[model samples]
Target: MIVIVDYGAGNLTSVQRAVSYLGYESLITNEPEKIVNAERIIFPGVGAAGSAMEEMKARGIDDALEKAFKSGIPMLGICVGCQIIMDGSEENDAVCLGLIKGTARAFPSGMKEENGILLKVPHMGWNGLNVVQPHPLFNGVGKEDEFYFVHSYFPEPLDRNNVFGVTEYGVEFVSAVGLKNLFATQFHLEKSGKPGLLILKNFCIWEP
Candidate 1:
């Protein structure tokens, strides 16, 4: 069964619904045993990185997640979940899970696009990805398809090899990362449309 980590920081219900919509058995729980034993793990998150890290640590969810991933279970992290998987985040001076060697940084204020038009923070709405590498998660998904995003911070992997996709707002940023058994996206696949659903479906069947 798939386990969705319920660390009090995620959009767990929507993730669960998305997995269910794809005909997969998923459970949303904060229990360590369930997470450690899950066939796959969905680590979905939103909200501030500092607060989310606090909750994960207080409830031992951090240890649970690390254990699960180390066991070779395929895992996916979304949004804030993706951020926390990095080494640190600029949000609230938060130290993240450090599962990936990277930092999450906020989009600078007073930003402008190539045309000098002001770019918005939060980086919401749909944006297309420039797929940089091949991975099982991108199976049957188009590189040009737009995915929904709702965040101000984006991950910057210390090792560029970890970056799988890039997207641009005021500037280009890492949109996706993959390493070993872990895969993560800054976008919200649950909120995205068909192309997004294809990602979820791919995850449900992904072996790596």
Candidate 2:
């Protein structure tokens, strides 16, 4: 069964609904055993990194996820879920899952557009990805397709090769990352409409 992990972060229901809409059944649970046994896992969240990590640890979900990853199960992360998979996050000065060798960084202050308009933090809107490398999660996804984003911090992998896609919001930032069995996106595929659904569908059937 596909498992949507719940570690007390928000946005669980929406991710569940998106999977259901794609004709795949999923369970939302905080149970680490369920997560470790899940055929596929979706770790999606919207909240502060510190509390999210705290909850996961308190429930032992953190160790379970690490075990699942090592078992070679296909896994996907979204938003804060994507962020905390890195080594650490500037969001709450919190150490993260370290699933990927990277850190999440806040968008620099005083970011501006070419037209001199100051860009907003929490970059809440639509943006297209400049896909740097092809991966199954992006099968059939194209250059023109835009995804929904809502974040102030972005993942920066220590190894540039881990970066799958990028998006510009004053500065270019890593928007998608992949390493072996794990893949994640900074944008919320659940909220990105058809294009987003396409990625979710791809993940549901992806082998790696």
Instruction: Give the Cα-based TM-score of candidate 2 against the true structure.
Output: 0.99
lDDT of 2 by residue, 15-70 (tens): 99999999999999999999999999999998889999999999999999999999
Q: Rate the local accuracy (lDDT) of all candidates.
A: 0.90, 0.95
Candidate 1 residues 19-53, lDDT tens each? Answer: 88889888889898888899999999889999999
**lDDT, candidate 2, residue 102?**
89
The residue pairs found clashing in candidate 1 are none
Question: Considering every candidate listed, which one attains the maximal lDDT?
Answer: 2
